[model samples]
Target: MDAVVKALSARVDAHDAGEKIVHRPTREEAEAAVRTLIAYAGDDPDREGLVETPKRVAKAYRELFGGYEEDAGTVLAKVFEDVEGYGDMVLVRDIPFHSHCEHHMVPFHGSAHIAYFPSKGVVGLSKLARVVDVFARRLQTQETMTQQIADAVEDALQPRGIAVLIEAEHMCMSMRGVRKSGSSTVTTVFTGIFREEPAEQARFFTQVRLGK
Candidate 1:
């Protein structure tokens, strides 16, 4: 059953890989959209102080959502198999990231905790963080981002198990609506051994909360 799940996950990853190659709007078009949004907000986009705001915003958007150009699999392509038979779980925690909410387009900033049990080899420690960043620098929900990170690791490394947990504070909630500040959203995903074994899952959770 585990093998079946991993196989299906790999197929899904392959299908998704092909879907990311869509055309994107030009910078001028993006700037024009920003100007339209500014006008929609009842602000004069052409005003002396606001005239350059659209250009600045367009440039910032490219950096903020740069994940669209990155491929998670490519980032995990280079692996190291000389672990001396170390099969224990590899955990990387407190990886800070900033992402935008898909619905509100507001910012959500926080950290992610990732872990995986290698079967034959392990990926670079920093690549784990890069995978997190690849999905983070896009419009996302915490739930989807958590699963994407786990799936990317599973598909690329075929680990014995994978676990991902993310905790973030969304500006959409803090800066508007209920105005609840300091409130964070936590999402988690577990696969393979992590999903089949409660003890392993518990350990992952405990380790994540230990220093917090």
Candidate 2:
């Protein structure tokens, strides 16, 4: 079966009496898994330098992967009631995020550039960063993460256009695959006006990229 199908099936199986599925990983399970990773890395977890590492890593990941415990829809729930009819392009740039690549379970550290044109009501400025965080906390691919973040924001705000860009360095490719330490990966997602209008997308890209 496809990944989506499997995920859906798992969700269905995990439903409660109200038919709602809770998807967040437990703190205990995550900490135990950190121990597993520590062992897999061929290290002694009891050593002084590494003794607190597992617990620290788990605690750190609780914040990093906090998205699994949050509803992105709810995070963006509060839209601006009054913007004084402010309807220009709303762009949030260089929103820092980190996630583990699902394939290798290695860290991918990056920043995202997000932009959207409001249709009617717009979201708060911080909501943009929260939306980005919701996706970046999971084990993911840069490509899918980019698309999912863009889709979630578009769905929540119903924007005229939405665009996202992620620039990350994958430890999997660097620490394992090709072993190139300095190379970074970039991914982008564009929808609505950004998808239909070439100039809009280019302008968005030029704005974020040139500034960097």
Candidate 3:
């Protein structure tokens, strides 16, 4: 619906800054849309068992897609420059996340591995996980999400090198199409030194796969 698209577009930063402001639809509108979906799915929306489903779905969507309301730059704004010149590879691995596949609107859950060689300073270890969560709580493809995470870090930290790897099992494939439940998709993005040096890329992979 136009209302839904407008509401979603209102939350995106890229659509701002010179674009006309589009107001987000009311909760009632969202619920109505959900009811429409139920009817389209051949379910009676007014049935007692399904009467409250629309409301529940609307609430769940707010939490699931809360990433649209967040800014990754704001999360990574505070840089800790007091690392005592300890410039080395900071790797955070096995960060669990669940995202919806943009194409099918089905879930793809996975772990992310992030590494950056700090130049100016370092960020809190937990911030890395938060960054991952920010991007994950949205409709996305694994490849685009992987690069978005890396780009966010690269922009915020200006790291000497950055490496990001994400592996996810898409429900679109497992629950529908091919029905390959255990098959996973891996995507990686490298910048700066990681892009230039194969040894650094190998080290990153080694660190991520260690003990696994």
Best by TM-score: 3
Q: How accurate is candidate 3 locally (lDDT)?
A: 0.88
What is the TM-score ranking, best to worst? 3, 1, 2
Model 3 misplacement above 4 A:
1-9, 13-23
lDDT of 1 by residue, 1-212 (tens): 44532332321222254644444566678789999999999999999999999889977986897787678999999989999999988999999999999899999999999999999799999999999889988888888899889888988889999999999999999999999999999998889889999999999999888858
Give the per-residue Cα lDDT of candidate 1 at 91.
Answer: 94
Ranking by lDDT: 3, 1, 2
Instruction: Name the candidate that leads on lDDT.
Output: 3
User: Can you tell me which runs of candidate 2 are displaced by over 4 Å?
Assistant: 1-40, 46-54
Candidate lDDT values, in order: 0.87, 0.79, 0.88
User: 1-212 in candidate 2: lDDT tens per residue?
Assistant: 34532353323211124656646455566677888888898997778898777778867865775666566788888888588887778888989888888898788998999999988688888988988787777778888888878777877889888988889999998899789998988888888899999999989988897768
- Write model 3 residue lDDT over 187-209, tens digit each, in one string: 99999899999999999999999
Return the number of clashes found in candidate 1: 0
Error of 1 at 25 (Å): 1.9
- For candidate 3, report its TM-score: 0.90
Could you tell me which 10 consecutive residues in candidate 1 have the lowest summed lDDT? 5-14
